[model samples]
Target chain A: MTDKDFTFTIDGASVTAQPGQTIMEAADAAGIYIPRLCDHEGLRHQGSCRVCTVKAAGRSVAACTQPAAPGLVVESETPHIQAMRKSLVEMLFHEGNHICPVCEASGNCELQAMAYRLGMVEPTKLPYLEPTRPVDASHPGIALDTNRCISCGRCIRASEDVDHKGVFGYCGRGIHRRITVNGEDLAHTDAAVSDHAISGGVCPVGCIIVKRVGFRLPIGARAFDRQIIGEAIEEKRR
Target chain B: MTAPRKARVATVSLAGCFGCHMALLDIDLRLVELLKHVEFDRSPLNDLKHFTQRCDIGIIEGGCCNEENVHVLQDFRRNCDVLIALGQCAITGGLPAMRNAIMHSDDPLRECLEEAYVLSPYVENATHVIPNDPALPLLLDKVYPCSAVVKIDHQIPGCAPSGDIIYETLVQLLAGKFEGFDPHIVHFD
Candidate 1:
């Protein structure tokens, strides 16, 4: 109960977190993986995805934005939370065409990996949306397949926060919400697709892919194919 | 007294590549052991044309892309007590459903037929001819998952779900424990 540090229970395990630290941060520090999409290590807490929703004191809260306090009890591994997460993932899948078999990011995609982590072998009983957003291959180094975007805001946030170039933005709302490039198209934007740009790699799905390297890896040697997304992140923490 | 009856399993491939069946065969030596408790009633393995009797379980290997696929799927549902959709094709429409994106067009199926069969570069001179045989099953406007056509009791997901997944699913089906299938064994290509 110190001023600088406090302990909270997540899934019945006591986890120590620093003052002002969010549950996601503390959980990551404690080697507990919380599924998220819009959240990144360096970005501000947007709390938009809600995939990290957890039960804190019996109320549902987005763990990525919820501050961890002393004696706070958080429930993450419960069937309800997992089902919600699965439904959210399923909603994302239904909203877009996440055909993993032909996707460039099939093995390395976070959305696919998250669905695997949550035990969603088949999509939840939602009918597929099957929206037909065109693929933008205008950028020489990068490609945008709007059909795969889940509206996680990762690229938008990364572009603004890390790249210092607000090249990406979200347009529309609800079912029509989509990622836009400078309110126009990628080719018209000043976004210089570079290897060092965080925007190039921040997308959790195959929506934004760097060209020329689509199928570089062999069938069984891709990122998530070797280790589940959680294990990879957990190993880094260890 | 007579011994207990063996479980009857039927498997079918709709609009999929026969890869899922190959993966099922990948069980290899385990197939012999599995045969002890189950018998194939209408699977490609046994070459049975239709269900002679009611089946305990049915494994569907693809999505519905044409009218015949829908009919076959409905027949499986009617004949089997439990139906398991196997492979990405059966579960998520897989690669065949890529055409589903363009289904809003005027006669998307005809357009696809024209593109692939009539105007394809592989063919010599463009025939500009589309098959319109009455015997052929009419193509659906869009490729649909097995569930879209009929109730799928269970699903095993993968491009061609790995042999391990098929084995585990079979084991679960034989034990009559279908709920809470193991996620570790499920994957997508």
Candidate 2:
């Protein structure tokens, strides 16, 4: 007798996945897009930026940071997750300077794109402000504009683990807190800082802009700009 | 007639671009809408020409470097009903804080004034020359982020935070419904 195929249901949609596949993997296979930040497929999960949070059996968890499980009822964009993410995005927005219109990252900025997708039109209600933002022009190929920084820890983490250059370490505190480069003394000197700190990459938002790479291409022609982040994320699952 | 209540605020600037302050002008259309509910005093915005009394809200930009930023912070705490850091300079010290790691003084101003301008005799004009004062405001010996200064109540963050956050903050304060966040970070040294 021929045996029936094994399958499971997620949010009422039935789909088949490997016997030990995780919920996230199953959902990815089924093409149910779950928004996330902090968990890059190319690297280890840091579980930062809770935007990818989803509800599984009335519990909230990060899809990117979590493994897929079988037969688990999931809710990707529940109100709680959405609200939490909206607040988180707002917090990140307020924590660092992430103005989309003027930022060089523009369409390439994940934070900006996500804010739009979530319809988070209102700005943060906090009245805090940082003092002066230092522009580090030390690295010939990169510039760090601290004002627009979100401090997702991607740069710091990338430096320590991936790039093997611990040039950037955090300093000070709230509103006053910042990411320091090589003790913050002599960054924009020459390629001296870059020579050592040039891990996989310095920053995610072009924060550590490559000096020689300036205006290399038209604005619309950049990596993330030409394609919608959501679309790209969904495409990856396929 | 019921008298209008003043919205308390304080303004400060540390190592900053002042770009966020400029963005406030982008809200030209809503200026009148805002003045209706709030008042501005002791703002570096009105004119750097002089200092005024503290009011309901205190807004600050720029990062703290040397001595002046320190005094300004004290003044805001003493006078303002609420002290709000306005932009990246104040929020994360934006780019200025990046300099705190090192106090290297290429002092771009010195080069532009002492070397570049004076040497360019071919193009130098009477008005184009710079003063030899080692104290010119343009010559920042060192850069700093504002967070190193006084405690900030809430941060608007963009290089200059968006006018949207600024205006929203003002409106909320005017309505007497502002719930600000602590603009301090606890460092474990």
Best by TM-score: 1
- The lDDT for every candidate, in the order shown, is 0.84, 0.58
For candidate 2, the per-residue lDDT at A97 reads 46
TM-score to true structure, per model: 0.94, 0.54
TM-score of 1: 0.94
User: Model 2 off-target regions past 4 Å?
Assistant: A1-20, A27-38, A41-62, A73-238, B6-10, B48-54, B102-148, B178-189
Quote the positional error of residue B142 for candidate 2 in Å. 7.7
Candidate 1: stretches off by over 4 Å: A1-3, A195-200, A232-238, B1-3, B103-107, B120-127
User: Compared with the true structure, what per-residue lDDT tens digits does model 1 show for residues B1-189?
Assistant: 988799999999999999999999888889898989998899888898888999999999989999999999999999999999999999989899988786345566676777777777785544466777799888898999998888888888888788888888898889988665555555788
> Where does candidate 1 chain B have its weakest 10-residue lDDT segment?
B178-187
The CAPRI-style docking tier of model 1 reads: medium
lDDT of 1 at A33: 90
Which candidate number would show the highest lDDT if scored against the true structure? 1
lDDT of 2 by residue, A94-126 (tens): 565443444566545666656556644433445
Writing each residue's lDDT as its tens digit, candidate 1 over A116-157 gives 888887534788878867787887778888889888888888
